[model samples]
Target: MKEKITYQDAGVDVKTGYEAVKKMKKYVEATKTPGVLSELGSFGGLFQLDLKGYKQPILVSGTDGVGTKLKIAFMMEKHNTVGIDLVAMCANDVLCQGARPLFFLDYIGTGKLDSNQAAQIVEGVAKGCKEANCALIGGETAEMPGFYEKGEYDLAGFCVGIVDKDQIITGKDIQPGDVLMGLPSSGLHSNGFSLVRKLFFEKEKIKVEQYLKELGDTLGNILLTPTRIYVKVILDLLERFSIKGLAHITGGGFIENIPRILPEGCRAYIDTDSFPIPSIFTLIEQLGRLEKKDLYHTFNMGIGMIIVVDPKEVDPITKFLENKGEEVYEIGKVGRGEKGVEL
Candidate 1:
């Protein structure tokens, strides 16, 4: 008799994937935000967006993924924190336009469904949505057996936000002489990890749990610290400060992100000495013999979000973020002629 072959034999069991969602439905409902109408297991997830208030409301949406940082999570056997990274990646971009995050969705693809491990990630997503003042409306988890190696997974997120047309933040309002306030990051915050992993694992041969003084924890512990959510904090600061623009420092770090907010004929003159470089960044530099320019261009190096504001609002804006237990710095001043960020 001929042997029978099936998708299950290749390891792509649709039933297992459906079962994973069944397990997550209860946990997901607990994080339900108001407008979420339908339950999981349906042909398509339903989300009702209600904008009962505001004149000239504009919808802002952003999609992003956690990048190869997932590899570290797999190696460390830590899956949860990356969920926050997923939300933060998308939410921060939407917030940059001064949009208030309204809802979030995530896509998690894995080789196989590990209910317990996957739930940990979903829980962190719920937590992140709350932190960003958004609803965990819905998400998708696919068990694509042949696509990924066993124990490997990938994460991506989508965020929807709203902002009044008049209140939208664009670099056009950001003129030369505007002050740039930098918000300190939680550490790395989901960028440049491919370089980090290469440096530590391949070059230095350091284990995830190995403790280093600068990072103040095992390598895995520090790197796993969830990305910081700047939405809630910046939303509140908008009232007191004429926030001309915002820059979320991620992959390209200062070199790329800061330039995004500069108006034509204007540049950012950053005072490198303005803020003390965090110990963790310093540690990476020393260990890797990383060049100064590479450090700033590759990692947050300190700043996570750069707030471009009128010079007049600097004092109060600094006080506001500082009061929230955030370390805010006057990293630079907007200047003309350079057309980009100058350190």
Candidate 2:
């Protein structure tokens, strides 16, 4: 008689997946807000819309992945913080639209299931959700044995947020004389890793643990820094300041992202010497022999979020952000001309 095959034989272990979910319950529940109506193990996550604060509420949603930054995590064998990167990637985008993050869901897929590692990753997600003041409602743990290489996993997150329709920051008000305030990033912030990996590992042949004096941290730790979530800061600023525009600098760096929020016949003239750029970016530039423009067009280069406010509000807003523990830079100003960025 031919042997019968079980689902487990096909590499899908229902039992192990259940155990992993069971372990992640506490972390998920810890991120629950008053709006979350479903438990962690439900088929779908539920969030009750809160309409108290707005006359016209609009839902804003964004989805993003950690990019090749995951490769660094795989190299370092550290899965904890990448989950935060996943959340930040989505949460910050919606924030650019003046949305208050409501709840987040994640999708994780791997070749093999490692329950402990899975739990660590979820805990990071939960921590990120809590930091952003959003609930962690649901996620998928897909174990495809042969599809991914052993011990490799990819993560993506979906975030839903709400904003008052009238309060949406479309940058329509951004005009000449608006000052651009830059908020510092916590390292690379989950973008441009494809080039980063090539420069550090393939070209430079550097090991994860190898220490560089300029970096002040090992290559592994520097690469794994969690992407910063700007939800709270943006929300707070929206309440107090007349922010003309907001830009979350990601994949295409300053050049690509800032243009997204600019109105017609306006340009951003950034003084490159205005802020203290972290050393990691300089290291990459030197090692790769990349031009100055390419360096600014790729990495965060220090600033993570940019705020365009009236020139008069620059001093007070800068002071307010400084008091709130943000590293603020008066990096540039809006000028009349082309609708692009200049540095």
Steric clash pairs (candidate 2): none
Task: Show where candidate 1 strays beyond 4 Å.
Answer: 1-3
lDDT of all predictions, in order shown?
0.84, 0.92
- Model 2 lDDT tens row, 73-111: 888889889999999999999999899999999999998
Clashing pairs in 1: none
Candidate 1 contains a number of clashing pairs equal to 0
Model 1 per-residue lDDT tens digits across residues 105-166: 89888888787778888877878887887877678888887788889888988999999899
